[model samples]
Target: MKELKAFLKSKDVSKSEIFKALKISYDEGLILQYLCQLFFGSIPNISILNLLQGLFKDKEEFSYLDHLKDIRHLMELGLVKTGYSMLQDQNKESLFSLLHMDISLSEYFLQFLENKKPLDLSINVAYENHLEYLKDEFERIKLYTRLSFNPQNLDFKKDIQAYEAHIKKRLAKSKFYNVLAEIFKENKLSKKEQIIFIALLKEEYSLKNEESSSRELNSLLALVSENELEKLKNRALLDENSKLIEKNLIDYDEFSNHFYLSESILQRIVNFKRLDKDKQLRLENALKDQEIFELIEPNTDINDVIMPAKTKELLENILKQQDKKVLERLSLWGIKNSKEVEAKIIFYGPAGTGKTMSALSMAKSMKKVVLSFDCSKILSKWVGESEQNVRKIFDTYKEIAQNCKQSPILLLNEADQFLSTRVESGASADKMHNQMQNIFLEQIEKFSGVIIATTNFLESLDSAFSRRFEYKIEFKKPNFKERFLIWQKALPKNAEFSEDFKLDDLAQYELSGAQIFMVVKNTALKVAVSKDGIFSMQDFRESIEKELSSSFDKSKIVGF
Candidate 1:
């Protein structure tokens, strides 16, 4: 009630002017009735409109009947109600229909009603009822309305006093715009740039304001040169750094190149700035690795890896198909020998089944750098924020892929958290699960570059997600012959072979190649630590027994 009163008194026009305008026509009776229910201590009905028209006759410029025609339709439908009972029966379709109407009209009515003064309990109750009826509509309307009304062009003389008062009352809770102001101050943005930045920030973050919020955004249309603004707008659509770039505030490319990052790495740097400090540090460390930094260069070939013959053949076939698809897409798009060709793949399997080794081997065989997607670092804790982070990652990948002339491979590890099956439960967890799954699906379908997603539990993923992937390679546990080779390859050159600890015997344990490697390493460590220079068959056997006991204990799963 206080907020509404403060809003109305701050306006230049008085209650009589609003009433005169609302009561212009016989048809406008319903609008006047609603307004009376909002401003005076009366229920909304046909009689209030008559009283309003009689009270505002001095305002000659106002007309009520003309606007009443619109309100009459609602009356005819019996949609108007005096209390919260109206909202109890509302359906989604009905709410959506009202929202699709002229949102500006809704805003006008809301603003008009908000300007009135005095403590009118009956009117306040009706206003609350109207708000309930239009809650969903208002949410959608506010999104676009706030976007349309840029706060940068506020008139100090006409708006400052009112805006300051409104700000203190309504927008005192938001700190996002304040944070943006700090960023602007720290960065020393130009006045024009600062205004544009604020508008963009409010649109992106959805801030609330008073006089400042009502400022015309059209002024920003002339602030920057057309070409520069378009570039900035497009970049902003991709990541936050685009805003800085649009203002010519910072050169991201130069900064990235100076740090010797690949195009993907550079884009990551821009995206990383939006993340929390711990995540930024993780990405920084990943970028510093020499193997990852060299990914910008083009890959030569990928057939040299000494993997199982079947695995190699399957990968080669998929790679060939991917190459053809890239050429076809390029031709259709009328691009000649384009360097930005993306091929995505998924590798799903049990732990120690060679997913990581295969990815690294593919990169090594092709003489290309493999860029892994750090899932743990990118998934945000804030609601609706994780999807944005994921989008930023993909956008950066695309930018880098396009710039480097080498299609970068994005390896998404432990992707089940994002690609989980959608459920119909009304729990908060379910909503987040659905949102993440939808975002991931959308990104995967639209992404043109190479992406490799790995997961241990493929069944946990949505069926729709599994279908989008071009290939799904299941790295099953190796057979005896494969295990024998793994053991032979993993063993040190100086190690002695004995009958009881033979490779063929060890292969029968059904252990993965990685497990075998660990077993051998641990056996050697035990021999060295015990001051026994000679590593014996008995020592290896004991180590294997100990490993089996410990592994069983770790693998035990209690029922939830």
Candidate 2:
């Protein structure tokens, strides 16, 4: 009773208000009124009349006038409405107008009753109760079925289980379930395709972040026997399932001998909140990224970046063409006929020259996200694994690009290993390397999204790969004037430079833009550590000398 009072109070009403509004004197009538709201959304006039006659039939004090008074109060409060006006002639001729409850309040009240099951009434238990109802329904529907029919005849137990599974899946609000239901209902799916799909779903649910539980098709082969697979293959030409691939409902990795359900579908099934709490958390952990690809928000604006004038001009023009309006206009004039626009660019030069910075800056100017692929993490020692990883990277980029207003830029920093020269196939290992290069070439040609790759050795890149790049901007070590600007940009405005600290004199050393930044950073660190955070000529000179020494050691190793 205390819980019941708390429940009503939580809804901004008291237990007395419920009794007064419903015009009920007994607690039984109030309990019935609340239950009526939960199941039927509102207590109809006839329902209230019936409840009172049934619950308080022995009580001589309860009368018809009592119900009418309560109904009128409920109407006045705007909590309920009559289907037809009570004062109208239509109501006098037949039954009284039916009362309808406010759906918003009814739902809110239902939630309130759920936490505190006053009089054992609850809407929160509806889903669980529905399963019991479905079980009865299953038995009723299968009553006439016989087990002696054929070997493939619907086994009553299996049929009931499948039906229950289907119902549970339909309860999900995920687009994956909606799409799956629609496709299976609209199209004639062969038993083999159906089996494959069910296997995929089963594998999808079985994944956990703690284990290597990837739902790869090869992994699923163990779940179903080879004999069963052969039978499914006989019923459908495997090629018939190509439509699924085209729709991206699933992906088949030919190299790995594995099939992958679309990430979107996997994400949906894993994230559906109806699953057990532990199971839901485990699925989330499994699907979480390894952080191999870093998401870089636009931080460096293009104008503030120092680059060759020609490079800046090229980037601006390319980005402008990528604008939706520009592309639409281009299509109208038949100037650009591709279904989607893409700009493949290469930024190549000596180490530390600002190639990577240029990519980040341009991304900022265009208001696009940058997905930086970690080359070391992606390249694998296993033969086929590396190629598969590369495919996953591109596929992920496509998925991310589709969800953004402006497609993100895929940045491959120090891309020499991926875009390296395709040597003659002198050995099996060499052939695999060439194969990797070919796969990259094919994917890049089909790609309709922006990509920027930076490399220190432009000469090491395969000619075929270089030719595919729409723009190749060489990042030369900054000239004296550019170096001075770079140095000025690096300086802290609050810091006072020594009178002898001449940037023009410092720029005489053949240092890259990155080296200049490093010198500034180190000089600042030195001031903070030794000079009580004061900027001076000695700190700057020491930092510059240290950078020169490191550069000389690197040049000896590479003969640069």
Candidate 3:
């Protein structure tokens, strides 16, 4: 008490107990002395205008610039604390607005300044849980947010270094920081990218928002973006080419202009406690009971089929989504809204054509399982059941998708009757058919996965249905060229052929690819049992005649 009295009575400000507690300069100490006197004399806190008035009472010693500089200096020293009413002002950057800010000695300093006691400024501020860390870190991040708008942001880098150091100090105790640091290390994120990730995480945990809009994300990103152009550059980090998105660490909803954590990363990084099931296992369990879909693992791909050049090109384009650059371009062009590729396609042509085969093959090309639903099964003998059956198709698909990570291709085969035009009729059957079509149309419009429905002819499709397809592929009955190729492909490699057998003669038969396949199989059987053991044109020709003949004779069973 005697040492303090000597210091207070002396002119040396450094020896004052208040200066020793705050560890501030002589000029800052002088500023704090007046603030402390006014704080208890009138109120616990002082208005910015009054604080200014009291601090610069001797105007000749300090200029107005010195007053403004001193105020910022006090703020920098953490001596003067400003309330939200000042920070929340949109025009807080203006001089008139700064005067409205209410200021006070920090609560930490107030105790010591009033008691004339030494202040202990040391304590472990590290948070114990992820939520607490997010809460504290979120507030700290807002300081940078305000700094972004302030022109007096000369100490920006210093502030950032301190924030980083604080985070590093807490990393050992903060699971959020540890997990996020691991992600950053794995993805090799730059300093700016790390800032963006932390801000997004703050938005997620602190705000309890799963997604942030582009505008909201941009403002949060202003910590790194110094100007409009730099902001554009920061925006590019969320674009299609972004490593954050390309690495599957982030997800974007293009339709909503929102960015969120990807599922693959969210479960690993976030501390949310929602119980989630293993969807792959759930899908496996559910698949055991379903009878409507014939699950197929196709042995063929798009390359294995012989189709029209135009058809081949279109299918190739659909498969192009597998390419990263192609997928990125798709999202950039707004052709795709999600990261995954989606298709609603129609394969319409003759019965013997390759519609069903192509659909299955396309699935194989994309490495997806096929859920082939015979459209005939959708029709029920019971009335009003067809619409329910149609609904069941989509409902079952959703269940499978939700229960599985990789969605299967939904292939609706032989859908001629379903795709037929809806009649404006009052009859029960017509009403039922129309209602079923409406349900089908609605599902098709909203469906975001691969769905290919095949009918015999595109002309059979209602215009409404036709418009819903991203691809309208027609499969013409194989002409001589395609049939020739099919014949070459279908020829049994293990079989022997007679010297006189000619492929041109077989290709000349105006037979569809299916007929040619049957011709080869039947001919191979006939030749296998022959004494000569050779595949001859005569053997194939006889099979062709038998296959082409529609009529069946009961007596033919005795032909052997």
Candidate 4:
């Protein structure tokens, strides 16, 4: 109290603690002391003319015009806000008009003068909902942006860091953070992009018109860059291939050189609900309204799938999305825009091959959901609506993809029904088929996610549809080695087997993975009900013959 009094009064201010806390030049400190008194004495806002009049009245020797530069310096330091337009020009005429311009101390500084103690610099605010969290985040963004006013002061950087750490800790307690958390969990955006999103979001919250939220491209680049070289590099964030642009989170105006939040984000602002859920919950609800797609959460790992060595290697490569460096390298090479390993694949082979199994196992390996669609059902269900349900398949998949943080695997079983060679000219029915094929082709061309289409006849697919896929893997019937592994894996460990029941004998049969699975099940059923509870060679031979004889049964059934 005595030090503040001494500092405020005309005395040797060097000994005052308030002077020390000001941390400014003696000349600047003298000007700030006058502003501090003005805050206490007047309406907390004063014109430059009145400020200078008071200063000269109190100290007749004071050269108020020379100290106008000091006032501008104080404005840069955020000790003062230079009216509404901080970017006002500093020409002689503008400086002359500044004598009548109104200014005020920053809220931060004013709070300090009111209490005579430093404000609580620590962030300790707890938010109960996402709305509160967003509002507080908006204020923090404004604070950091204001700090950018004096970028030369490294201390402002430290202050922004301190506030950032505090906000992050506070955010960690919430289950959701709106779009920011959504994009982060999806691995679709970097922090620089997240800042740009939140900044535009804040502008939307303020009572400004639409155009005010749109910022100049150079200013946004400056927000994310520390130097000119870095700014030049950051221009790619607005590139056509960047995630911010590709995901449709931000829209850029080429003619005006401005960037704004996309309409999707703006629509979400008014009624922003939780954009995240528990990972398991997301898998559970991903198919709630997916009438054409069945969501499957797979437990089988790719290692369990019996396949050729090359096939296994390719399946394992799909898990590269789990490796940060691999994803980064792919992104660097421009192979993938987002962190996800986007793939359009065709797993083709005869029936009973392991196309669907491998697809589910690959999804499990990546910890993603599988939205499996039966393309055969398209022809079956489109009976009353022939070929009309083609576009709905891709649209439903896209809707599911948006809700899933991890891009769900789109498994199109029996896609050959539509992807077969398109009919060029024929009757009305043939024209409808061609139109359906054309729509299907358009969707696949624009589709950007992990997608796998399984077909019994890859040879029948149209060249146009085949060209859209980046991978065309053949899932042939397992040979002797693969069949042996499949037989060994499918056999029940708990069921009793006769001493003569050798897997090598079963492996001798040329069975696909699905056929082997069925044979083992049928043979196990026989042993389960038998008196001895044993699986003899006769029971196995009978089951294998039954499966081979029923090869005409081309029905497909999937289980998790």
Candidate 3 displacement at residue 368 in angstroms:
0.3
By lDDT, is 1 or 4 better?
A: 4
Q: RMSD for each model, in Å, please? A: 25.0, 21.1, 14.6, 11.9
Candidate 3 residue lDDT tens string, 1-560: 55434444557667765466455567776767666666646776767776666667678643533565566656543346664221122324444555667777653244233332222223346667666665556655654554454424566456656666766676655433455555787578987776666766666664553422212444445657766467656876777788887776777665554567667677776643322456546666666666677767788989999998988998998877866677778889988766565889998876777888898898877767788888888887778998888888888887776644358899998889889888987899888888899999998998887999989767768999988997888888777788789999999987788898888777877677776787788888788788988888778878887877742321121111
The TM-score obtained by model 1 is: 0.42
Identify the superior model by TM-score, candidate 1 or candidate 3.
Answer: 3
- Per-candidate TM-score against the hidden true structure: 0.42, 0.47, 0.50, 0.50
Off by over 4 Å in 3: 1-290, 402-405, 551-560
Best by lDDT: 4
* lDDT for 230 (candidate 2): 48
Candidate 2 runs further than 4 Å off: 1-288, 322-329, 337-341, 402-405, 552-560
Weakest lDDT window of 10 consecutive positions for candidate 1: 252-261
Instruction: List per-prediction Cα lDDT, in the order shown.
Output: 0.49, 0.58, 0.68, 0.71
Total clashing pairs in model 3: 0
Identify the runs in model 4 with alpha carbons over 4 angstroms from their true place: 1-291, 380-387, 553-560
The candidate with the higher TM-score, 2 or 3, is 3
For model 1, the local distance difference test gives: 0.49
lDDT of 1 by residue, 1-560 (tens): 55444334433223344433333343344344445444454432334245335545555654543343344333222223221121122333243233223211222234444533331222212222222322322332332233222223333223433433433333244332233334465456764464444443333333333222122222232223233245345333223344355323332222212111123323432333333567546545545532223233323344422357877787776554324345566678876354443456778878777776777666544334566765666556677776677666666665444443245567776676666678999887667657776877888888765677888778887789878886788888777678778878777888554445555656666677777788889988877776545666777666666676777334322121
Per-residue CA lDDT of candidate 4, range 395-430, in tens?
Answer: 667766777656789888988767899777776677
Tell me model 4's lDDT, rounded to 2 decimals. 0.71
